[model samples]
Target chain A: MKIKNILKGAVFGVFAVSGAAHAADVTLNALFMAQAAYSEDDIRNMTADFKAANPGVDVNVELVPYEALHDKIVLSQSANGYDVVLYDVIWPAEFAQYKLLDDVTDRIDDKTRKAVLSGAWTTVEYDGKYYGMPWIADTKFLFYNKDMLKKAGFDHPPATWEELETQAKAIKDKGIVDYPLVWSWSQSEAAICDYTTILSGMGGQFLDADGKPAFNTGGGLKALQYMVGTINDGVTNPNSREYAEEDVRRVFSSGQAAFALNWGYMYNLANDPAESQVAGNVGIVPAPGEAGVSKASAVNGSMGLGIPTKSTHKEEAWKYIQFLTSQKVQNKYAKLSLPVWEASYSNPDVIKGQEPFVNAAKTSFAVMAPRPTMASYQEASAVLQEALQNAMLGTATPTDALNNAAKTIADLQ
Target chain B: MISYRKTVTAWLLLTPMIVIILGVSGYPLIKTVYYSLTGAKLIAPDLTDAWIGFGNYIRALSSSNFREAIWHTTYFAVISVGVEMIIGVMVALLLNEVFVGRTLLRAMLILPLALPTVVNAMMWRLIYNPDFGALNALLVQLGMLDAYRSWLGDPATALDMVIVADVWKNFPLVALIALAALQTVPKDLYEAATLDGAGMWNRFWRITLPAILGPLSVALVLRTIEAFKVFDIIYVMTRGGPASSTKTVSFYVYQEAFAYMRVGSGASYALIVVLISACLIAGYMYLIRKHGEA
Candidate 1:
């Protein structure tokens, strides 16, 4: 009886050890945006690759629209939710202030920092702390239909905003399309991006030296005037007031508009014969500058992947984020969004099929402008969006609209 | 002894339901009330101790944005519910008739009601698409429109368009309820009305109207509440764009608490909305009681 008991105890010990090993498996829930930049399938596939390398870690991915991304991250803060989350460039200040994201400053080494583009670093930094890994280095580019330009007797895409307007006028006169330009000027963050691009191109400043509202004057006023002028002149699609990036893509892809201001993702999609009607006729350029202000314009529309502070599986989440943001993974999927790594810009594989995109990226990235980084950015951006819409809809003049926005934003501060 | 045991057993049976109600509804209501008076942030509710009495409520009331949102909500509720009531009764009256395809038509009415609101909103979004939307295409083809125009994009028509979508999805529910009520109305009343030399309109106003008023009022109250708290359809369709023309009180509250993380002000806003809803309910109940007595 004693011998049988010993053998049974030994078998139970083996079972206990195996159960402990099995319990080591970690399941992580990661959140990503469904629209623009990298596609949902690309995110899932990259995660799958990460899982293959790290056998013990399993990831569950959830994708929401860009408009919902900020709220989702903030709402899930206390729920112990989202081990890994994709965040926008404007969120780091707010997130860092709330301590919603883990400070991974030490995790990013000097060698890695040196290799990554310096501008991309700003996406994940706030108050000198790194909140995440910058994943998408994106900007809005000028997309034009080559056929329409040719039909309008223009040999080259416009090099400046004035030239672009002239070209648009030519296209409209030739009856190539009813509206020669379409923009994602909807009352969302998208409108802010386009405004920032134009504002920067016109040498406008978002704030004065003391961080006061300054956009209502100087180049800011010009940017709004320029946007309103396009609509008033019947060159810009009036429906653009209601359009987001996707709507702009649809209108441009369907050959309804000759020129569209959209993100980098539109390039490959607009050129794909399966997706766009005028695929081969697509032309890419950096958003045009003003004559004396800038050579090219772009918004620092990058995004990052971060580990939520509430995550219990922080180590595993960091591993997944690192794998996703690594140069190899980013370069492989550079068709939709360019890599943040400086060397990837010169990689033949990244540039082979999309030469114009690569060339435009080279110029645009250098001049990419940022929206104001503040904890109240969301509210301020809302005010700006409303102001932009009111001006565009002719409910208020640009001066009055921007003045109101400045006042509201000043009150928020 | 038997009576005492019965009382004890009943109390034991009711305890679980009481606990559940207190846990789900009571706890949250109390917490929301507590948070409304404090300057609490959404991220860390426990850390807040700044109790600024009624400050948030004052701010919310004085804000022009909040006032606009309230107006939008009221407009949406009144128009959508009013249209829904009219169309619902007409459809119910039509379906209640002894027609060959009555049963099939009744089943088909369930299709719109059965679809999820998000799916309905998405479908309507496509139908209203500026470039290739069916509505624009149809209107242009029929010569009702000179060109394709943005329906949801324009502030003048966006809310109305959303109301149209809401009405399409919800009128079937009212129709179903009204139809059920119509079945319970006796044939004798109508025959008596006819014998009394009543016209078609008179019979409808005197006999059918009174009989169905009770169920219709219930539908009215339910739909009014739903429409006043409208968020999902607007979120899916517009995200309250084109200059926030379609932004309702609930969407405003959502933006405050979740998007902006201002939990304190958000709670106050929510309570204000609740107060408005309560007043509406009370008004409805008073009217309903008067009708019942009459």
Candidate 2:
């Protein structure tokens, strides 16, 4: 009888532990990129805060490089994949087509929609439906060395693309820097971002009314020509053909380049004395536009956090995303990436040390151009990346390269 | 009846391994072949509706980019494996001799081979950095180079640079294999060859060469298959950049399936790679059979 009693007690103990686990504990897995925008530590701390507020809910975060982020998200879909994934602005069409992300249109309310910046909505919106919440409101900005400019006899930063080139030439002639300009023109999405900035500034369209390739002529042709011209004139760094965004930042921060085209995250890092050699000499401005086209240029390089369709703990995952994108959380960690909420721009804490960044962002966010939104955007981008590299490497003329890319992308459609 | 019982027990003991092998590799291989014939989307729920036989193969064969990738893979495989074999045998012959610190040198040879390919690739990337790399610094300081130049960034030198890194990490493996084969060669053979008035080159060409050829060929076939499927090193080092100059067949398949989300076409490309690897494997089996007969 005593042995039977002990056995009954053991069975009851196992039941009690498992019963408690099934009731309240929900662990959500989130996938995030390690580069740019929000730092990994900030995401972890924010997730920790969310967990503290909601007892028995935990978030396991995994970070990957931006180049590997897309593949990881897709590969994990067939399995019990990530509950939450951070997606690039260019991926919504592809993700929605494949049903990789859950449609959260009903979860997002009008109040939240109105609070966030209008441009940020584009990051998660596809086919008039919302797939996720925009967390990173970003665009490329022109970073210049004020000391180099001053030494080259310039009082103000360039206001147009031609003026920027003239200043770069002046800087180069004055021996301020061997390569006055550095760009992320490597054969990747980064090169596309830079190309889009110039193309948008020159008033180019990626597609026509019938969704045909339109980037081969007019302003698109001019943009590629200008890129090739800089390289040919010995003003742009030759090594930039292998550079990505981080490389551009490194070259700029080391005082090797007088001017660079990079994202908003570089503004703070480039200004921090601990991280940059040319800290105090860094200056920020919107990317210059063409003489007759526009005032400034930018590309829609934002990212969003979404729940994948295969996630089991989606309710808890959505809660975590909401908390992370909440105004309070975003404002607290606004050093690296600015918040998507429009009201946070007026918040003194957000603007205290980043006044120039905020000022440039105000202009840039309005004019940020979107890359072509299609299900085959990745393939299209690859073709364009090669074309850009071909032109930059002098293997083909800019016109020929752009035409070939247009033909290939047209076939992809 | 006793022998029959023993055979039954043996079959029972091997059942788990057979099941495991079929589950892990056999199932995936069959599924890949099935997917290659169908027009399946990677993320789609239903895969039964889209079947287009031989279409993906034709498309892959027609693409210039895929053809270029095949050429690149061929070039990488031939050069890296050929160089590795030559260097490996030389190192093995040298180490086979009576020398001081032979044990220490053998241990050191394992270092590069033991390092993970990703780590090796990353180290080589840093070493090849155009602006501040150790290579450029050394070359400039030695008065061999006029200035710092991009090594992996230029299309003309990127693939060759990657080959150099691959050889560095993998030649040690071949050396170790060759060294083991060399030890089994009888001391009497070299003594006999020298007694017959053979020179160092002749002895190496006749006795040493034949003794190590069997193991060396095995290493050659294995390295050839591996070098043809090179992805991680290229992925980490240059990402097929400066105009896709270093893209191999594996990288092409990865992009087609994962990046582009065309599962059906990607499967076809992957099967083509497998077919090529299978051919090499068949050649390996034939060589081994011939060696056994000899």
For model 2, what is the alpha-carbon lDDT of residue A241? 93
Please tell me which predicted candidate would have the highest DockQ against the true structure. 2
TM-score of chain B of each: 0.97, 0.95
Estimate every model's Cα lDDT from 0 to 1: 0.94, 0.92
Predict model 2's lDDT versus the native.
0.92
> How displaced is residue B8 in candidate 1, in Å?
4.7
- In model 2, the Cα lDDT at residue A30 comes to 92
Q: Scoring each candidate complex against the real one, what DockQ results?
A: 0.77, 0.83
Candidate 2, chain A: TM-score? 0.95
The 10-residue segment with the lowest total lDDT in model 2 chain A: A18-27
- For model 1, the superposed segments whose C-alpha errors exceed 4 Å read A1-24, B1-9
**What's the DockQ of model 2?**
0.83
Residue pairs in clash, model 2: none
